[model samples]
Target: MNFLKSTYGAMMLVGLLAVSCNRDEDMQQGTDTEEEQAVETSSEGEDASDDALEMAYQGEHQLSVSGGRVKNTLCATVTNDKVNKIITIDFGDGCVGPYGRERKGKIFIAYSSEVGDSIANRIITFGDFFVNNKGVTGTIELRDVSINADGNLQSTKRLKDLTITFPNGQKVVYNGSRTREWLAGAGDDDPTNNKYKITGTVTGESTTGRSFTQEIVEPIIADWSCAAQGNFARVSGVVEMTKLNGYSVRKRTVYYGDGECDNVITITTFRRTYTITVDN
Candidate 1:
């Protein structure tokens, strides 16, 4: 009788241990998924904002070159105030723009002077903007636009209270400052040739309520030609993302590849490294 009782007790102990181990594994998996989602969603938001900035600059350039005569374009309806140096672009109900992305609502740009002029500042705000069914709310201000020592045009990109809400009701908040340097194709009439290098640090709260900090360890290459060809706008770079909560602190290093125009990116986590093809 004593031997039987001891055996039964040991069996129960083993069962409880198994359940605890399984529960821990499940929690870890859940957290990993959340980290991935957070990075992905934040990246999407940044991409949309970059497109909007480019559009606004193009519109301003067109107006400046045309003596404020052109008001409408294939992408959106543009309106400008020459005296105030303000430009408003309304995408209206919805329209398919470059890269096969659907955008709607409006973008307002208040420029200190001509967009590329030295020391000029452009303050950009959104009005009910929706990109591919995701709502974006934020202020993106380009400050101190000037030519750098390398003969490249550069500006300080500031994002304030930028919030991106997914179609599934999840919201991600982003705030950061980045430096963008125009590397080439500045004089081209075709925007697809434009390229820029971006370096910055971003900290935000993910859709799953996890806070993370991102640092661009390598300057990210933003090539419009790649995006125009249905690829991700960011061609190459390395980003380190650190999650602030969960079972443990998670650090993810993302590699965008060696200047390839593909949508593939590899992410290295504490547990493993994985690749994902983004639908840009």
Candidate 2:
């Protein structure tokens, strides 16, 4: 009887041990299966995300070049994940004039992901063109144009660069950046209720062994009392000059255009008056 009882106890212990081992193995297998499932789900999600991103930028949009010396009614398309864009100039019927005829040149722009922003480090390839005494040869990178969150136009290209070309074969390069801040209605005694100010600087180098640094500090004052009648009472309190370079002195002028109400001012030597109808 004692031997039988001992045998029975041993069998019970063995059975318990077997059950525990089996449970542990089942738990481990379950954990491994869950881990694999999670990995598969994550991989699928990443693939879907990549596919969506790829599809989001595939399309074409027409681009037109107007204003300035660009008289041609050109059109272009944005395609290939927005990485490649091509612009073609039609020069339009002869009625479009000579400036349009000159725009028959080709332009290609390519974007790289390595570059942080589309405006920075972009490769803008320009083709042959004859404008005034300037002749195009090789493709040079277009730099210094900044597109901020607000889509304001800010560039470091000086007035001299806008008009002058290097006598040497080399091209002038703009390498610096600028930020402009405008403040309106800061002073209580200010007469112009739409009083505002702008401050920024531009620094760049020339291939002709010359360097340039310019500082801009200016206030834009506009009287909106006359604004209702398509007129503006304006004054500019700003001074701009290049410390070491020979350039024209920045002077103040009265605002006359209909589109001159914004802080994003376009300083031009030409003076023109336009009837402005203010919107509520």
Candidate 3:
């Protein structure tokens, strides 16, 4: 009911937040090396993994669904009002990458099951989730959410005529189910368990004022490797996008990012064969 107002609120939030956060450095050198590495991946083997596009204001150096690590720019305060039976999570300021960029918002949810010191697989509906700061801004309605025993998130998000605007005044109206997971965990020196990796689908118009459907053929991999140094995370998969800037084309896309938390991930299509900067 309050989607449009919240969206505008989110946009305004970004407009204000953008002036505060420190800007990231250039990523050109990082891109070149990765491009060269991608060229060699086919002959070598499959990449480590894809990344998680879902952003939760959890902690610093959390594992991403894409297999990389995420540094939470905003360490949200989690408060549960026992009397009211409500859980309020404030995502103050943070970076959500492979996409959805940096965000600062809040989520209000109510759970049916008992939520203890630790929330494990607790099914909760009626979530008022909002994320916006720099790269992305939007509110997500939680239909149902349950975190596994392993602390991996499994949930369905609703986007009711939600609009996510890009830098060029173009917007994407996302309306669909965002089923998600915590793919990989934060691991340093090959740490085995943490939270990394996110996979799901949002179908709708690729840009504002356009109508079409796009379905990813498989789980698009968001790869954030284990290495502590270097800005390297990628989004790779085959998608059938019937309308992207008015083009009906289904192609495999591989996006390489500088891991700068800047929402800028490179796009490479068709069998690891080309490179294009984000929104360039």
Candidate 4:
């Protein structure tokens, strides 16, 4: 599998949270900005985010890259205040999907919210984040990144000092940035009409001179009814994969959720449907 196609679900599914927190700007001064590497012994810590966002994060989002399905668990809590929170998503230990792909990682995101002068709302930006997927460890630097008062994520995400180790012992180093947004729908009223959709644009290259631009297709709506021990259930409308290597649109994928805490999803792409079984 190619790079984008392989990691597509991981990046795209998480982008679903780009929607705003009620469109009202939450501005604060001297917001507690600190990174606590200490994993709280208790799964439950503090509280943060609005109901919609809180439910989404606490539940967590995961995507299996191929026909084979995978399950993961998510844990998110306010370490201190609303601005400061910790989100951890575990994709399990060496889960296998398709095309000889096996991944095991726990993505940890620590962020603080502050008002921004320009660009995004500067509501909640990441102070430090590490993504481990398929033996790839990427440290994320979110600078001036904010989900605007409008709830559209407005910031440039810089991935620095990234090293992905292949099963064969070969490693690739990459650094890149991805800007995200909430495309359509505002609230959680109607999934068909008021879907909380989000998208992103990634423009970055690897140390090996592999330059890439990815335009992430937004989902139709978001589902946040299920929240128990970081078990999330989501159904995406349709997604597009734009490979900028030669500027071509590759695949269009759609999702259908069972709307149950069972965490199973039906993924459709190019007239072929794949049943993805997600678990906590």
Among all candidates shown, the one with the greatest TM-score: 1
Q: Rank candidates by TM-score, best first.
A: 1, 3, 4, 2
Highest lDDT scorer: 1
Candidate 2 per-residue C-alpha lDDT over 5-65 given as tens digits, one digit per residue, 9 for 90 to 100? 9999999999999999886565444332332222222111111111111111111112211
The parts of candidate 3 lying over 4 Å away from their true place are: 1-74, 91-102, 114-154, 186-201, 223-234, 244-274, 278-280
What's model 3's overall lDDT? 0.39
* Cα lDDT listed for each candidate: 0.79, 0.31, 0.39, 0.34
Regarding lDDT, does 2 or 3 come out ahead?
3
Whole-model lDDT, model 1: 0.79
RMSD per model, one decimal: 8.6, 26.7, 15.9, 20.6
Count backbone overlaps in model 4: 2
Tell me how far candidate 3 lies from the true structure as C-alpha RMSD in angstroms. 15.9
Candidate 3, 103-204: lDDT as tens digits: 445544454443332232222221323233212333445445567676765556555555444344444555566454556653342322333433455555
lDDT of 4 at 98: 17
Model 1, runs deviating above 4 Å: 1-30, 69-74, 114-119
lDDT: the better of candidates 1 and 3:
1
TM-score of each: 0.83, 0.31, 0.47, 0.35
